[model samples]
Target chain A: MKDRISALVFIALGIFFLIGALRMPRTTEYGKYGAPGIVPAFFSIMVVLLCFIMLVRKQRSNSESSSTPAEVKRAENRRLLLASAMFLAYVFLLGKINFIVLTSVFLSVTSMVFLRKRFILTVTISVAVTVGIYYLFSRVFLLPLP
Target chain B: MYTVKVFFESIASTLSNPVLLFHLSWSTLLGILVGILPGLTATLGVAILTTLTFGFPPEIAIPMLLCVYIGAIYGGSRTAIVLNIPGTPANAATTVDGFPLARSGMAGFALNVATIMSGIGSIVGAIFIVSLAPALGALALKFGSWEFAILAIFGTIIAGSLTAPKDPLKGWIAGFLGLMIAMIGLDEIVSFPRYTFGNIQLYGGISLLPVLVGVYGVPEILTSLKRVTKAEVVLDFSKSERKLSYLETIKKNALNLLRSGIIGVFIGVIPGVGEDVAAWVAYDAAKRMSKEPEKFGKGSIEGLTAAETANNACVGGAIIPVLTLAVPGSAPAAVLLAAMWIHGIKAGPLLPIQHPEMIGYVAGSFVIATILMVVFGLLVTRLFLKILLVPTEILMPIIFVLCVVGTYVLNGRLFDVWVMLLFGLLGYFMRINDFPAAPFVLGFILGPMADTNIRRALMLKNGDISPFFTRPISLVLIIAITLVVLSKYLPKKRGEKR
Candidate 1:
């Protein structure tokens, strides 16, 4: 069932790529062979074919193993989602709040909430790590970081 | 006589410079440090350090980069053995037997064996590079557009199929997905902007560094964060039991060492293939040939040695194609090629002609780097074992920040960071579905070559695809690709009692 859904997603993506390739402007000099869309079109076709095979394989397996493995708990799923959300937010808000400040907050809050750690230890470690990384990149390695 | 003179000259040049020696030694240790940690890969180490070494002279810069590249590849085994979490993808095979050995209170012994085998493998590969690079470069010169196109296809197919031992369909899909992603920017052939919906940032195409870091690093952060409370490392083994009979073991496993090293070098010489493939292939072969095959994967010393030797040897094998043909055998080698370019040294068939001393210098640098790897690997085993005790909660957040900084520092673009995040999510999903990410990486690395070559080949034939089938090398590649794909589907005739 999961494989079928994944295959459907791939098929959709492949079609999208095929459409994009077809819509691309063709150069006159290289004719049909050297068109910029050639490889993309080929790739799209290949992906769709492979996804179909995956769907077939998934179907064949369904008859053999009716039993399914345990699914992730709702709470665990929620945690993963929240972690992803926090990460995206960190990237989005990197420059606005400054590097060290934003990272410290993200780390402290993440460890405290998900890890169920002591707030004081989390905060201290978060601050120390953020500042240490900042010094290493900016001062020691001389790399510019946002 | 000529080889002897060139060899001595290379050694003299490398040893004469105090600065070069320092760079080689220091960068190697730093690289091993980076590789010991989870989330950081050898490719990332080299890419980030390329920026730092940009101001140095080519002589110092190139050696530093090579040392880091070699060191990181060797260092990944440490974490694989001690923690069971491979520090790099190449060490994945090592973890099969290495972690089992560690669990059985043989961590120190395993480290010693890994260190010795890695050095031996590296030296063998280095010898091949110094002797065969020019000849291989000449062979590469014979390749035309059709041959290159076929070679690219072969690489993608083999990499996809090999990366996923259980199911290759997912690997192929991931590889194709990567190729599709590579087509999103401007078309190299026509110079027309592709798939870019008027975004200025999309015009330059996606950077490889950010994609690599995001795909590998982000998934690690997500997974490690979820498992906050993991088992701590146990370092209670006795000093006497930890002592390894290195010379005796090497003598006993001499044939295994030779065979695995050769296999590793062979895999490394193939463009777009990497050390992980080499390690797995060598491991499988070793298990098949072992007198006690039952011991395989259950703390088999032979299995661990085969994996470590091949993966380290692959570093040299990878560099061979990069310097000779301007084609990287692995992801890290691709970055090394870029570093060479940055230092105004053009690689490929013309490299030896333009810079006569380059092959010699590279050979010399690799030898020095491998010796340093052995030295450091032995010296730091106990030290690195302590790092396994650090809680993931603290370590992961720091690594996540480093990933962000590493991506952002490449071109100082916020857009790259966004790309990293996007790929990170995609990579996590891919991993959950058991789709191999390495094939995707290989596809991205080889995409341009595949794209441009196919178009060029077509143009040469005036839209006729016959040459792709008719050319000798192209035909061989097509057959090889067919065999690889069909081998998966071919039913075994085991039950048919004839």
Candidate 2:
């Protein structure tokens, strides 16, 4: 099922690239083969073919049983989704908030969520990591942080 | 002989610098710490360090990265021996005999053997790089645009084929996807936008650092979170046999060390096939040649030694192609190539002529790093066990923050952060689907070279593709690429044909 979706995505991407290649300038000084679109067009065709091959191969393979129990699998999927959401939020808030403040909050909250029961240790470690990174980057490496 | 002189000079200079030695020790230590962790890999370590070392000069920074590479490869064996989990994919073969040895109260002995073998293997690989890489680089100087284009295609195709030996189709898809993504910015030839969709940020094209950080970093973070947390593996050091000496271990596996070292260097020189494959190959070869073949999985010292040696040796082997042809020999080497570009030096045919000292410096740094790995490996065994206790819950968040900092350091654009996020998701999905990310990276690195060279070759030939087939080097590359693709479907023979 996942393979099907991936194949469709690649096919769409290939069509999109083909359209983009068509819009690219064709009349370069060295003629059609030297045009900027040639490589992209070639890549697009290859992608479509490869994705098709993947689709065919996946179908031919024996059906694989899910290794995890349904409930455990669902829990893992939810955790992955939530973590990705948190990361997205962190990126969005990075520039607006102070670097150390935002990072500490992200770190402590993530630790709290993942560790769940270990509050004090998570808080202490979060603060320490934030400060240590700030010092290492800004003072030691001389890199300016966001 | 000239190479030998330059090599010694580099070693003397590097040893004289107290600051350089200090940095080398520190980075290699950090490399081992991360390598002992489950999700942290050599590629991730080098990528993060690449961002951190932005302020350092090329000489100090490059050595530091090499040290980390060596340390990480060796460090992975520690986890494989102690915890029965291979920290890095390259350590997978080690876990076969390593865990059994650990269970039998020979964990310390196993580690010592691994460290010594790793150092020996690295030294062999380093010798190959110093003696052979320059000659390869000189040979590459004969290549023209047509040859370069063929070489680039061959790299992408071979990487895709080898990354997932069982499923080359997915690898090809991932590789082409990377090439397609690389085409998003303005075309280098005509200075025309290819697929920007009118977004100004896309005009300059996506940066490699952010994509690397995101693809590798974000997925690592997410996967660590999903794992069922376990307390760190506790060691039983109370046994009297735990004090086994390194000299005894070395004496027992002398022949295995030499054989595995040769196998590792050869595997490392091959494009796409990395330490993981090298270790397995060496292990299998050792088993077949062993006086007691049945003892392999039952904790033979020879098995553990062969596995550890080949993987660590791969680090030096992998650098050969990167320095000579600008093509990476492994996934981590691809990042190393990118890091080289991030620094002022471009690696390729002109590398020897343009930066003659680079080979010597790299050879020198690798020697120091490998020796340091052995010294530090023996010294820091107990110390790393405690570090391994740190819960992934706390460790991963910190790593993710480093990822953000790394991506942000390159070009200082929020747009790059978005690129990282997108690629991170892509990497995550790819990982879930068993699609290889290494080839994607390989494709992205080589796409421009292939595009530019193919166009140049065509223009020079007035749109005739004949030169790509007629030229000696291009024809050889073409034939090699065909053989690689064909070999994928060919059946394996049971016995040695000869």
Scored by TM-score, the top model is 2
Looking at model 2, give its docking quality level: medium
Off by over 4 Å in 2: A58-65, B229-232, B242-245, B490-498
lDDT of 2 by residue, B167-202 (tens): 787888888888877888887787878788889998
- True-structure RMSD, every candidate: 2.9, 2.7
Best by lDDT: 2
Scanning candidate 1 chain B in windows of ten residues, the lowest lDDT window is B489-498
Candidate 2's error at B368, in angstroms?
Answer: 0.9
Over the stretch B1-498, how does candidate 1's per-residue lDDT look in tens digits? 344356567677777778777888889987887777766788878877786776778878887888888788778888888888787888999999998898888878887898899899999888888888877877777788888777776777777887786787887888888877888788788877888899989988888878887887888788777652365454656745556678988998898999999999989987667899999999999999999899988999999989988998888898998887777888888788878887899998788778877887788878888878889888875686676666676677777877888788768889999999999988898887778887787777667878999999888878898988888878988999999888866643243333
Interface DockQ per candidate = 0.60, 0.73
Q: Per-prediction count of colliding residue pairs?
A: 0, 0
The local distance difference test score of each candidate is 0.82, 0.84
Q: How close to the true structure is residue B224 of candidate 1, measured as C-alpha lDDT? A: 71
True contacts kept of each: 0.61, 0.71
Count residue pairs with overlapping backbones in model 2. Answer: 0
